[model samples]
Every structure is written in C-alpha cells, then in structure tokens.
Target: MSGSFSTPTLSTEKTFTFYSQEQGNAYAQARPDYHPTLYQTIIDHHLDSNGQLETILDVGCGPGNVVRALSSHFNYAIGLDPSEGMLTTARSLGGTTSASGLIRYEVSTAEDLGTTLPQPILDESVDLITAANAAHWFDMSLFWASAARVLKPGGSVALWTSGRNRIHSSVPNAAAMQSALDEIEERHLRPFFEPGNLLTRSRYVDLPLPWALEQPIPEFDESAFFRKDWDVAEDFFAFQPEVNMDVFEKITSTASPVTRWREAHPDAVGTEKDVVRMLRRVIERHLHEAGVEKGKEKVKGAIHGVILIVKKKI
Candidate 1:
C-alpha cells in the first residue's frame, strides 16, 4: 500500500494571486535576475541529456522573466501564470527567440498547464519546462501530473528558488547585520508569510518529486533527478554585490509578506511606519553604528539559490 501526503497548500495559488496590474509591474522591476551561470547550467544539462530546444514552457512565470531569458535558445516559448496582472507586465517586456519567434504569454495556472488556451498546448509537445522563484506557489500534485502530460519523452523540468536573503560577508559587523535582518522577519513578517513561503525559505528541500507522489508518474526518470545549491558567498543569483538602503527597501517591498503586511496596514503604506520603510531605517542605524558614513551605506547582499532538474524518460 502507498502512503499519501499532499504538498503544502500555497495560498497564493488561489486566494492571493496578484491583486492588481501595478503590483505585478513593481515585482518585475524590483526583483534581481538570476546569474548567467544558473541558466547555462540548465541549458547544458538539457542539451547533454538530448533534450530539444524547440519549445519551452515556463510555469508560474511571473512577469515572464525566466521564459524571456531562455527564449533565444528555442523556436517557441510560452510563459503561463495564474495572474493576469503578471502576464500583462510580461507581455509589455516582450521577448523573441533566436530565429525571431514570438513568445506567448498566457494566463493559466500551472495546474491547468496550457490546456485551457484557445490554441491548447498539444500533449507531448513541450521540450522543457521551467519555474523560477515561482514554483513554491504550485499545487505540486497537479503540477507534476500536468507536467507529465505535456512534456515530451526526452524533455526535462527545471525549478529554482532562493533561500533567505543574507548580508554579504564584506559588510561591517555582518553577523549583527544579519541578526538584525532576521529579527525583522521574526518579529513582523512572520505573521504574513504563507505556508508556501517556507518552501522557498528551505531551498525547496521538501518539494516533492514525481516519484515521491503516492502514485508515481512513470514518465519522469527518478534516477535522473538532480539538485544543486549556491551559497550566499556565491555570485550566482543577484549580480550586484551590494545595494544601498533605498534599493534594499524596494527589493524587500516586492516580497509577498511585505505586500500582505501593507494590505493589513494600508494606512501606513507610504509613510515611515511602512513595514519595509521601518526595516530600512533599522538597517541604516546598523550601518551607522558600524561606522559606515551616511549615503555610503552600500551593504552587500547575497541570495542562497538552489535548482532541481529532472528528466522524462524516453
């Protein structure tokens, strides 16, 4: 008999999808891009394992960044997200393939795959599927089932997300600075974090694999599953080594918990009392205490990133 367990239900998948168009645009602008090495690693693995580059589907593709980045390598690329607001921003920053192929941006949740589209994605047509910083919100059971339905025999799935943000080692009193940052999350943001957030926080260690399901999907090769991690010291996620408090404020505000906090305290949205604003001021004081001059507090930040790739057996 097989035991049964469900992946943690991420609220954002249903009740908390992006509330407005403006919010989605802010997210695209504020978040950092993944390092080239991260993409290169996925590309190399796909090609090495005889995966085709004809078509790629990026699920949970907020603002279309991952699909946009990978479009140049494939003839056809489509990005799907449950949030129409996010898909709106994604289309605005349009991308094309190496052969100048257009990228399709669709408003469909990962669980639905592209089956609901007017031109529904044909079964066994996708060559590669990717989810970047967005997989944590997926219903993995539906995700893997639909993924297996759409992927070609030799296709692969690549999923990646960052762990908690960390103060770069070079920052003065970095240990204390790190502690200060942790305190903000502990005292304030903790209340707003949804269950899915923990998946990313833990670097997806507990994210279920196809074979881990109660009724395993036979298409994926359990033997071909792979995982890789990059520490905070690694230059693999955000390219910038440091960001001043203002930029830090912007980045932090893009987080889901911050958004939720703002929702709960709408009156404080733009003021000093804003959760992220107050957090930034605390960091500023930390910098001053560490002897960093005003307007020169360029603290380093690094995101611990992890990627998992699994191939479909031919």
Candidate 2:
C-alpha cells in the first residue's frame, strides 16, 4: 500500500538537522536498537571478503548507537552526524573503543565524511563504513565517492533500513488495526514525508548503488554486492514483540513523518486531534471492541528490513 513517490533527496537542513536537544533525546528513547544479527551479518560478510577491522566510520550516526555498539570490534570508532544535539547525546552515552584506540563523535554529514572535521578521518584508513536507518537521507552518489576515499581498498560499506510497517497478527483485530495505522499514514503522515522516507519505505529498492549513480564510483565491487531482506516473521525490527499502548505510542511518535506533522500543527499536538493522540484513541477503541480490559492491551507490529553491503574494490 505505497503512496506517491518523490525523487530521492538528501537529509536537508529543514529536517533532522533541526533536531534540538530535547528532540534528539526523545528520538534516542523511542527508536529501537538494530538487532545483533544485523551487525553480525555485516561483520561476517566483511570478514569473509578479507576486510579489516581497524577503523570504523558510521555516517549519519545519530545518538552514536551503531559506533558505540560496535566499538569493541574495532580499534578506532568514529560517529558522524550533522546534528550537534544528536552528537551530544552520543557523547553522554560513552562507550569504550579498543585499549589503544579512542571513540569519538563529530558533527558532520554523510557527504562530508569527516574531511572537514577539526581532525579529519585518515584517507583510506576506514575498514568498515556503516549507515544504519540513515542512508536514505543521503545523496548516495556523493556518499559512495566519499566512501571510496575514506575506506581501505577492501573495506566494506553497509547500509540498512526498515520498510514501512504493519500491525502484527497477534494484535487484537489485527486487520482492522492495520487499516487504522495505514489510514493515519495516508491522511496525516504522507503529506509531510520527504523523499528520503519514500526510499526507506521502498526498502531501498529505489536507492542508488555506486555503480548505478550518474557518475558511477568504480571503486566498489558490484559483483560481490550483498543484500538481505527480512519479513515480518523474520525478526528484523528487534523491538519487543509485545508492548503497552503508551510504549507503542512513543515508538510511533518517533517517525520522521510524524515529527514533520507535529511541527506543522503545534497547536494540535497533545489534543485529540493530534495525529499520535488520534492514533491512540483509535487503538483504544479497537481494544475495547476486542474486549480488552483497560490498561491490559498490548501492541506489536511487523516491519520488513533490508541491508545492502558493498565492498570497495580490492
């Protein structure tokens, strides 16, 4: 049930770059961490292709979640994001790098790839470059060119994002609940969605690969490209299989489109007319119709996921 598509666009100043300290904190609290298998799959694939594990650069690393989680595996870990608020949150949640190395965060963009940082990343030194749930926000053609410069000859680039979601079959009146969710997306969120959101919703099938860009980056080995997809039953989201309504609401509120909607209708926020609150009311009504006791209802949903892994030419 996809809507209209837009040309892929970069993460613009008008969007996530506007994230304030409070917004970033709320984002960190609401978003689910990537599943361990997601990381391991990237690592195993990279290792199988003889990729090194010395320096990692996670682009668009909001809240530094990926870098912090993968810190122990690499000697040096660097996270870059355009938002200072997100970087600040990342720094506060400090994690350890290798004994002889350091963990750092820089306010930077995927297009920059740390070249303009006070301490620029070493050219051809990064062993793994990752963009988790963030690549759709990039100008991929530019990102690939920058990746070529920052990555070692056999380094790997891993990009992953979850697709548009659905209510899990376990939820009461799951079909009707899904329709309500879809209705919200159509009536409330779609208008505010940027092109990047469309790409993620398409599971990156519409995203450009290095070789497919206007000025193709030949440094990547398209022949060895790797992609994996997980369906609703495949556990890609890694969020709790069950959650209370309040927790569910927080999760739903973190969506980029919803953020845009809230921004546009500040007065409606928290009122029954608010998109989130409206969703809650509908959900509550569904629960009541399904004979759920007050405060006893739970919500769980399914989202497809896809990961794209490309290796720099050896």
Candidate 3:
C-alpha cells in the first residue's frame, strides 16, 4: 500500500503534515465507515428520560464520519477538525437523513473551543461530544478543559479507536491472509507510528483521560464523572463487507504510514514497480497459492473497536 524504500526509515513527523488535499481524498474514499449501531449504543446510553438530545459536537472529526453517522440523534450536530483538507472532503461527501437534524463542519482544533464555535455552543450547552480514532492526537489537557466547558450538566463524552487488531477474515486461508497483513504492519508501517499512537496500538487501554488518574483533574470531579469501557463483543458483526483485492489495497493505502511513505518517495508511487504494487503482488501471489483470485474471491474481516465513555454530573 506504499512505495518501497531501501534507504533509512522516514521520520514519523511526516504524519503530522500528511493531511494534504489528495491525502484527505484518499482517506475519505478508502477508510471503513463506523457501524450505525455503535452510534445508537452511545445514544441509548445517554438519552434523557424523554429520549432527546439537543446538540452534539464531534471533535477531530476526520472527514466528518462520526457526525454523519450519529447526527440523527441530536437536534443539531457540529464536526470540528484542524485539517481544512479533511473538512473540505467531508462537506463534499457527508449526507443527511430525515431522522437527523442540521449538521455543520468547522475548521477548528479541539483545543480552540470558544473562538471557533458559535455562541450557542456555550458553556454547559452540548449534550454529547465524541472523538473517534482521534483522541490520541489531542492535547488531553486542553481537550478536557474544552470538553468540560461545553458539556451540559449530564452530558456524555465518548472516545474510541478502531481498525487495530480488528480485521479478521472468514476466507478459507484466513490465517495466511492475516499473517500477510500483520507482516505488512510489522515490517512496513509500525516503525512509522508516533508515540501518541500507542493508544491505538494498545487497543485504547493506554488512551489518556483526565479521570484515569488517582487524582482526577478538577474539571472532571471524581464524584461527578464516571467511566467505562464499551463492550465490543468478541463476535461483533463485521463493520465492512468482504472486499476484492483492489479494495483491500486501497484501504491499505489510506493508512497514515503508507501515505507518509508515498509522500517521502513521491517519485516511486503509481509506477509499475511501486512499493504498494509490489506488496500487492506478494499478497496476491499468496492468495493465488491459496486458491483465491483477484476480482473473484472476496476477503472478509471483523473490525474490532475499543471505546471509553465518561458522563459528567447533572
């Protein structure tokens, strides 16, 4: 999913600057969408007695995926991200349903709450705030301060990361295929992952939170805030369908490390012998040896997610 290189490994700092318009397009086009049921679960867990939510804010809403998926539950929804490129792609691609209320996107960082948000998003006004596959990049100190400022008395905050150890295939040669994917990560991508990514690599257990410490941040008073891991059942249904080889390759290309690799070695991408194409050739050969064919046999996998939810006092 990336160009091959025999030179020294590229620095992970590239990732922080990787969200170009083209990169944003590729990410929006290839990344898997989250499950609607996951949004429903968050809603059911926080709905008031009347089962209504007035406003929702999604922080670090890459391409506005979570907002697009969960907007239906609230009277109004807003998605905020620092990446203007991502917001551009999101506005062009996001959709709405009758069940959903008005949705908007903002080019704002999570730490810049008041300056970037509308007055209606005042202190203690938002019912729910979520960050999916994004909290790892946040300055938790600033984020917690902003989250506390905007959340309503009984509001909820949910953070989650998916696509970690998550994909499992049902193909006959699933084990071999899984191994191939693992090798791609271990050999080609893992080294480029940033320290903040430890939260994702550890399946969210290492995610930073104000309430996780023995002395919780004053903003998240221990008596007022409560936390729990969202139970993603071992047998949770697959979030994505069985995809053909081309689609799988596209998905892999959307990965940050792969994108960074391409950026660092632009001269090598999209060529006949590009690293991504080479990787694809190897994986395809493995599949063929196992009786799978390109464009014919579909590869399926289960996506795993780890979520943590915290509720503020009313």
Candidate 4:
C-alpha cells in the first residue's frame, strides 16, 4: 500500500490541469480564508486615495477568494483564471451575484489576457489589480507589460503570497524542514528550476506606483499586517475532527509533486490513484514529524505576509 512515487522528468510542453469542478468546489470549502486585516491593508495601500474604491481586477483568482474578500470595497470586481473548473467554483462561491452585481468571473490565462477582456475594458479602465498566490504563475515580463497597458495612470498593482506553514519554531525542526525542502528542490525541482525546466521561473519587478491620481495614501506599513507562525500540531491539525478532508484532497491535487508525477508518468497505469496515495503519505508524515500525533492527523503552521503602498510618480 506504500511505495515511493517516481519523480517525473520536466517538460515545457506540459499542459497544466487543475482539479475537477467538484474538486475545486470542495477546495473552496476547506481552504483557509485570508485574513480580513490583509484585505483592509491592501485597500488602504492601493485604493484608499480615491475616497471610494471602484473597479478591481483579480488575476489567477482561484475560486475567487480575493473577489469574495474584496467585493464590498469596489464598485465592480472581475476575477480571471485559466482553469474553467476553478472559475466555475468561483462563480458558485457567490461570485456571479453580489449585492451590487459587481462581481464577474472570466476563464483566461494570466499570460494571455486579451481573450478575457476586450480592448475597451482594458483601456485604462481598472483602478486596482491584485493577484494573490497566483502571481508566481504569470509570465512576469509580459504580464507586467500587459498590466501596465490596462491599468489607469494612477492604478495600483498588489502581489502577495503566503509562505509554507510550519508547526514548530524550534531551530532544529526549521532546519530540518529547510533541508528537506532543499533536497526536494535539488532532487525533484532543481532541474526544472532553470529557464527551460518544467516549472518556469519568472522574475518579479517592484510594482510602480502612479503619480497621476493623487489620493491621500497611508504609509507603507509591514507591522500593521499580521505576522503569524504556528506549530501545525497545535494550530492546524488539533482541529482535525472538524477538518474537511475533501478540501485537503483538492489542495493536494494541485501540488507540484502530483502534477509533476502525472506528467512524468503519463503512460503509467493507475497513476492518479498512486499520486493520491503518495501525497497523503507525504502530508501525513510531515505533519507527524512536526509533532502532530499519528492517526490523530492534523496540520499546524505559520504564515507571514507584507503590504506595500506607493504613490504614482508624477
């Protein structure tokens, strides 16, 4: 019942496929929601100047988490994702109908956005552009250039991602996790880290603030943002009795290990089941080692994020 899943060779020709619509819906249910403070900070940093936030664009908006979180702030919000399954889930998450009819969902790739929005919509029409956790998948150069084209002169772009959650803060455990990640990177992700590797590495540039729209903006503050670290044993898994396994399955299905294994062993029979088993074991072992009791199955971890604010250069 237990066997190591063979790592797959990386390839650029691979097509990224996310979980099914059912899976995406389940994921939307189980995944932790972002902090409200984080949303307020983003608004303060980017949209506060106008006195009233208007149009917003969410790129790679998986299941419309950002859209749901910020729908009330903007006059209108549009969410775009490449996966139809994800978009379907997003729409179902009250995205299709909001209080103001301001939320909309589009199926589109971050790299190819033209298909998603018409020229009129792209022409300096948006006030804010935000990507949460999805920025890493973008073609940085093209995406930034395209984003610049669509954004109003004074519009703001916010990119933020959450780091891995760890259960313990002990130096030894931290070091061990680091080492484990390093080994995985070297053994599985390294060859793919290069330009032509399976996973494309794109450099992100510091977002430029617009000076044309002068609205009173708050000072860039990192401390105001939540800086949290958790021991998964204590924080995440302890609530396992209430933890939703369906959500866990959906999240794991999108993991790099699962996707890479699928690509590497495309012809392998029963690959999907094998991938699932392997992921469950990996997650369980990591959780256990992090101090969660075995058979008690839970996850604990910490997350730290930053908020940046800048006015456009006049």
Candidate 5:
C-alpha cells in the first residue's frame, strides 16, 4: 500500500507575491550581476570531469540573470519561474539570446518541472540543472524528485544563494552609513521579514535533501530507476559588490520585505514618515556630510554565497 508523510510548510513565496511589474523591473535592473567567474568555474570543472555539457535548465530563474549569462555555454538554455511578472521583466529586459545558443523563459515552478516542460524535452536529456539564489524558495522534495527524473545519467545539479549585504566606502562617514543601513534591516525591516529570510540568512546549508545524512544512500536495485547520489557544498568568499551610490540605493529599494512594507504603507515611503526612505536619506546625508556627493561616490558591499552541487550516478 502507498504511504503518506507530512511535508514541511516553509516558503518565502509571499515575499514575492507583492512583486509588481515595476518592482520586477527594478530587480532585473538594479540587482548586481553575478561574476562571470562563478559560471566559468562551474563550467570549466564540469567540462573537465564530464564530456560535452550542453542543454541546461535554470529553475526559479527570476528575471533570468543566470540564464542570460550561462546560455552561451550550452546549445539551449531554459529558464523557469512561477512569477509572470518576473518572467515579463525577464523577457523584456534580459536582452536577446546569443547567436551560438539561446534562452527560453517559462512560467512554471520547480514543483511543476516534470509536466510543464515541452513534450519534446525527453526525460534524462538535460545536461545541467541550476538554481541561482533561488533554491531556498523551492519545495525540495518535489524539486529533487523532478530533478532526478529529468536529468541525464551523469547530469549535475547546482544550487546557490547569497545574502547579508553591507556597504563600504572610502569616506569617513562610511561606518555611520553602514550602521544606518543595518538599522533599517534590524530595526525597521525585521518585523516584515518573511520566513524565507531565515533560509536565505543561513545560506540554505540546512535545506532538506532526500539522501541519507548519516550514511550514503544505497545503490539502486534491479529497477535501475534511481541513479547514484553524490552531493557537495562549496563556498565562494570575497564576493564583493561594487556599484555607484545610486545603484546601491536602487538595489536596496528592490528588497522584497521593504517593498512589501512600502506597499502596505505607501504614505510612509513617499513622505517623510517612510522608514526606508528615511534610511536612504540618512545614508545620503551622511555621505554628503562626509564631503562625498551623491551619484559621484562609489561604494562596495559584501555578498557571501554557497553552491550545492548534486550529481546522479553514471
């Protein structure tokens, strides 16, 4: 008889529920682009170990940043996301696909990977599956099951995310600017944080996996349905985000919690009563007092990320 078990009800989906087209566009525009080396490192290592690395699927590919960057390496790249707003911005702003390879965007969630993909996309055909800064929002059980079903014999899965942003500047008031930003998060935005923020803060290290944690999952039986399981977590430090003050502010404005809060209290954000606005003003004022003008100053920020790669048995 078939059995049933409880599934965890954990998600940060609501944080994105309030994503309007404007916010989606802002996210696509203001967010820092991942370093090319991040993709190069993975592609180089995969090519060295495996043979030709072609077709790729980027799950929960909000605004399609990873797809646009990584598509050239593969013959075909597919970006899947549940949000139409995000997909809209992704299509509009992600630019044209290259002549060598192309990217296609789909409106689907990680859980729907099995059925939502085109009929022509044969099972066990995908070469690589990636989730860039998105795995935290996925229902891992469903995602992993679909991944196992769709990936080729030796195909790989790469999941990564980053968080804990900070500001750095050459000016003397940099500490005050950093402090103001920290207060905006801890003091103002803390109450608005969705449960998903916890997962992001932890860099998804404690995320669920089907394989046994204590010992290796046993080899597949005669059924030969399940592939061999192997997984590793790699950390990428020294991921600093350098941008102009304007871009930095734009990035902060794209914060989901802050955006949601502003949506609820529109009057606060536009007027003097707005905490986010106030936070931005405080930083701006501090910068000005430090003899650095807005739009003219450049600041660096911190971003810590981790990649989890799982490979099926050959």
Candidate 6:
C-alpha cells in the first residue's frame, strides 16, 4: 500500500472556526454517541487479560465525546485539540479529572504534542491513541511518527467516522431521495470524486501514519466491532425547513463563488433577502417533487465502521 503521492493541504481559513463552544455544545447534543459495545470490543481485542488500560490519548477530542465514553476504562486520559472552543465544550461535558486525578486536557495540534504538553509524553509511553473524524485533517507523516514516538510497543491506534445514511426506508420518497443524492453527487461531489482528486487518489494509499510508524500496521478487523443503521427524522426536517434556510443564506454570503457573484453585481447584497426567498422557493419545489412533507418523515440509514485492536510490533 505504498505509493508516491502528494497530500492535500487543508485550508486554515477560519471558515469552520465557528465550530466553537456554542457549535460544539450543539454538536454534542445533536450528534449521536457511539455504542458502548464498540469501545468494549476495542478494549477486548487490544488490552491484556488483566483488563488494564492506562495513559490513553484522544486526538481531536471534539467536545470530548470519545474521552467521556472511554475515560472510565483508563487510569489517565488526555484530550487534545487545536480548537479552544471545542476544548471548552469538552470540559463542560464532564471531561475533567479522572478518578485517579490523572486526566487532563491540552491545547495542541497533532504534530506538536510533545512540545505543547508540560511533561513531554515520551516515546512508547502511551497505551492507546484514538482519532475520530479528525484524522483526515492531520499531516499523516507527522501524525504517524508522533503517534509512534508517544505510544508503547504494542499500543493501539483507532480511527473512526460515521456519516448520514440518507437513503433509509423510513423516508417517504426513497426514489426521490436517491435522485437528490444523485443530483448532489453530479453537481457537487463529482468534481471532488474525479480521478486525481484528493479523495479518490488517497483512497488506496497506505495513510501517512502507518508508514511513519515504521511498523507493520495490522489489517483492519471489523468483526471485533459493532455497526448500526437508523433513521433520522429530525435531520430531514431541519435541513428541509429550519437550518437550511439560514445555512444557504450564509453560504451564499461568505463562499467565494457567490461572493464573486455579489462583487460582479454590486447590488446583490441589497437583494440578499430576495435571494434567500428565491432559494427557498427552489428548495421547496425540489422537496415537493421528492414528496417531502414537513414533519411527515425523517431521514434514515445505516451507520457502520470498524473498531480495530491495533498493536505495534514488539
């Protein structure tokens, strides 16, 4: 799985900077929590018979979801993130001290962990490292090397993510919903999914972390994990009626393409309300075609991911 490749650089622009304390708190409330069995499975496979796990590190601990879930299992846990707002939300969500008074939070990036934390967590000191949804933003080479430096021999690293299943059976118009997905793919996702694009190109490559670790990464084991699929009625309506209106308005205002359009017209900002009004009309029409009724049905789908009990070569 080795290859010559250039990693895609993420934009540091503060576009998503608004995912601050308020946003994080909202996300914690709205986002689904992971199943407890998932964590147990990872522990079962990765930990020894004594069932002891100490010194866990959670990278990208958004609102401390993973930390809160797994903290009880470890003697000491640290949640690290670059976003102060997110850290604040995490702290608010019971991400404080461990039972043994060993838990802590650090503000740092994945690559700078050693420098940022007071007592540098040494090479082969950590027992487990987990990154959820945030691994995609990391510099793989640096992350892998750093992770290896901080982890003990035979330590584990887990990467996980979940996405909305928009094509569930609970929705009223399944065919129309699929059509919408097709349209989104055709109009939005196609450009990114094209050959040579970042997503497509990196799908097959061994990620930077594994290569950097200088160890043979184990094959992903899915049987040790649990997966579930469900319907999301609330998400459907919120997107169709509530937040989508505001989101569309803001995106048109802030995004480069639409901002460029506004620049060309000069009078566009004055008519912004009308623009939102018209956009709503278009969305409403599409929803009608898709047989979407307010509060009628909810979005549904399956969610699945692996929980690997990774171990570094001794």
Write candidate 4's Cα lDDT for 1-314 as tens digits.
Answer: 01122112111213333556975776576666676666776777664554236788888787888777887877778887777777888877775323477478886665555444653346666677777755545644455555656666567667665534332443224555545645544664344332222211211222222221133123222223222222233322213233333444555455454456656766652443455444445556665676767666643344433333332221
TM-score to native of every candidate shown: 0.94, 0.95, 0.82, 0.65, 0.79, 0.67
Give the runs in model 4 whose Cα sits over 4 Å from its true position: 1-20, 48-52, 96-99, 111-120, 165-167, 170-250, 266-293, 304-314
Kindly state the number of residue pairs that clash in model 3: 3
Candidate 2 regions exceeding 4 Å error are 1-13
lDDT of each: 0.83, 0.83, 0.66, 0.53, 0.65, 0.54
Error of 6 at 244 (Å): 13
TM-score of model 2 relative to the true fold?
0.95
TM-score winner: 2
Clashes of each: 0, 0, 3, 10, 1, 5
Q: What's model 3's overall lDDT?
A: 0.66
2 or 6, greater by lDDT: 2
Higher-scoring candidate on TM-score, 3 or 5: 3
Query: Which model, 1 or 6, shows the larger TM-score?
Result: 1
Question: In model 4, what lDDT does residue 215 have?
Answer: 30
Deviating ranges (above 4 Å) for candidate 6 = 1-5, 8-18, 48-52, 96-102, 185-206, 209-293
**lDDT (10s digit) by residue, model 1, range 145-176:** 89999999999999998887778777887888
Model 3: per-residue lDDT, tens digit, 45-86?
777422248878898787877888778767788888777778
Error of 2 at 291 (Å): 1.6
User: Across residues 70-144, which tens digit of lDDT does each residue of candidate 6 receive?
Assistant: 887777898887777778888776753346554577777776655557776677778878876556556555666
Model 2: how large is the Cα RMSD against the reference? Answer: 2.4
